[model samples]
Target: MSAIPQERRLVTAVPGPKSQELQSRRTASVAGGVGSVLPVFAAKADGGIVEDVDGNRFIDFGSGIAVTTVGASAEAVVRRASAQLADFTHTCFMVTPYEGYVAVAEALAELTPGDHAKKSALFNSGAEAVENAVKIARSYTKRQAVVVFDHGYHGRTNLTMALTSKNMPYKHGFGPFAPEVYRVPVAYGYRWPTGPDNCGPEAAEQAIDHIAKQIGAENVAAIIIEPVLGEGGFIEPAKGFLPAIAQYAKDNGIVFVADEIQSGFCRTGQWFACEDEGIVPDLITTAKGIAGGLPLSAVTGRAEIMDAAHGGGLGGTYGGNPVACAGALGAIETMKELDLNARAKRIEAVMKPRLAAMQEKFEAIGDVRGRGAMLAVELVKDRTTKEPDPQATAKVAKACHEAGLLVLTTGTYSNVVRFLPPLVIGEDLLNDGLDVLEEAFAAL
Candidate 1:
């Protein structure tokens, strides 16, 4: 067998001349005010390095929005997906059924936390999985209200928009969101309502009580949350908060749904962030890295609750496509064999210190938070006031991108820089990315 590629060779400046030209073309080709984080147009990728059209190679820390934990263009994943494509591309699970789909479901059932009999339904995106989870919860609990947390990001779908906490980009003009969705406060300690470092489980309990009193516990079908909030600055809820919420949901018959779409697949040092608290959610939604880079998602949960929906209620036209399922099976196998969970911890080991160093030097870095490979740094104008520094954050991110490191920014206030490097990234390349970040901070 050929050896694994291990080099990050750059032959041109990032977003080289060709990439800039292509970006110009993209502006007219794409619609809906589509935005791009990095300007480089990928021509090829292996391991942790991505090569653009102009042959400029750079370290990837965003991992395609956290979808390539195994690394971009993994050998096993590509081999399996290509071989499956040769056999047959589509045999939609709902229409013709396929073994690959069943195989993927079985893997998810075993991987997701919970020894209780669990079932999984596949979909094309995280939003679809989340939307379906809501449907299943309502069907099982016979309730109408759905509760969400502040700074949480579910998806861009109408229902998910209603569930998402951000308003400007996600909910802007997208009005008349699905009804019965309500928002609650998350345990964001750094920007705590009372004061810095003042939020914890008690605040979460208060939010829960408010929801119960205003919306009525009996009417609530589910309460969805990210064990480690992703787009919301990689916030990890205060200790005990997740467990308390899980218990409350159990007592009230409100399905506890963990939105692990960005936090799953060992991104948070555990296969699922919910596992960190030892809390088994009634429903768990996952996507992104599950199928390597393939567009595949799943909603796994208690078998009884999952089965509550009718036969035709849980399927989509392209849900669980055979090709994507094959890719997922291969990706899962690779993750187990390579021990990606350990890899995530390794990434955290390297990043936490480097970021802490940056925080020590940069007064704008108000907070550095996250569990593992999924991490973020929140920018603020002043430590005392904690006013978001969106402009400065954007400047640093742009500089990093131009200097050969692809990064992503996310937050309710657009002042957070999230790092989701592929767990398979090499030590040297990872360090180089961090060095670029340091340079960006200096530039800012």
Candidate 2:
């Protein structure tokens, strides 16, 4: 049986009676530091639709920040996790290792797009995965300094924040960040030192030369990057960029870490986005969609590097929760059975034309970029000037929300509208969501 209810209902306003009541209670009880996106509370979700407490059903384009690739409330994930609940929940892998944890790790080792011997470690979030990957790289290389690219986002943890480049929201006053983290320019074609249309091997060469000259690669432990940058604006490095970086890291004895937290698990038309360029990173950090909406993350990489850390030093209290592992098993099986990679390609096919047409029609659209289901439309004042139109972007986002669609806006400038629909969405519903976007643009 489908996990969603038979019908959707919206008897009152979008926030309606129940949501407003909850909002009042939230204001009273919750800490002021907590923030919210849409005011509507989630009642249930399935396929690519989120039903709010007031019964408003909206087409989901964000996919819970790209975490529910198998769709929220996927049947297989629910069933597997429910069955595993009958077995047990937490054993704290450090205290006592469990088969479920090992099983999930084994799956990751096999599936993370590498023929080399690999080992896997599980954690609760992308931040944890990134931290652990850093730990592994530093331990294996016995180096102190790490190099990150400009506009890259690792996570929100203090160490990851140091690894992250943006400062306003993520690092605003969160001073005393971790030490030995260096940031350099990313090969972002849109705003690179060189022009957009000039992205090629030369761009990669320039960045690498700067890194070598400035950081003196010998002191760097790892060069962590996103195969396709996520919060930095869905920017894909040029054709020769990833390979060049990988080769540079290899020659310098620096671990090449692929932060696939937002680009793995078939979200980018492949098992991992780096695979598109045949770049096999020494370490890969992944989360978001790994467990079909469950809180699970993993760091998979060369067995030697992963094993460099001491045994008791690696796991957390809830590192590989049994339920999340079961969910992951089901999620991976669902991906294989459904061919979500092919689905992502199909989504790209639909989104590219629609977004390209919008770029032609709207003066605010500066760029249409990204891969597969992971796509974005960058907003600007004028195509030629490329001044960010944050106000117009906010208006369009609000319009889409009011019109029964859940679109997400992101970017270093907060002016890019990103689309991350669940891979399971029907093409017709997907098209309808795109049409809503068009209406939003028109209203803006």
TM-score of each: 0.97, 0.97
Give candidate 2 misplaced runs (Cα > 4 Å).
Answer: 5-11
**CA lDDT, candidate 2, residue 204:** 72
Q: Model 1 segments beyond 4 Å from truth?
A: 1-10, 193-198
Q: Model 2 misses residue 160 by how many Å?
A: 0.4
Q: After superposition, how far is residue 346 of candidate 1 from its true place, in Å?
A: 0.8
Error of 1 at 257 (Å): 0.3
TM-score of 2: 0.97
1-444, model 1: which lDDT tens digit per residue? 213345555676776889889988888787847777776798877678777899777788889999988887777888899999999999767788888988888888889888999999999999999999999999999998999998999999999999999898889998999999988887888877675345676667788888878898889999999999888778889877888888889989999999999999988889999999898999999999899999999999999999999989889889998888888888888888889999999999999999999999999999998988998999999998999999999999998877888899999889999999988888888898999899999988
Each prediction's RMSD to truth? 1.6, 1.5
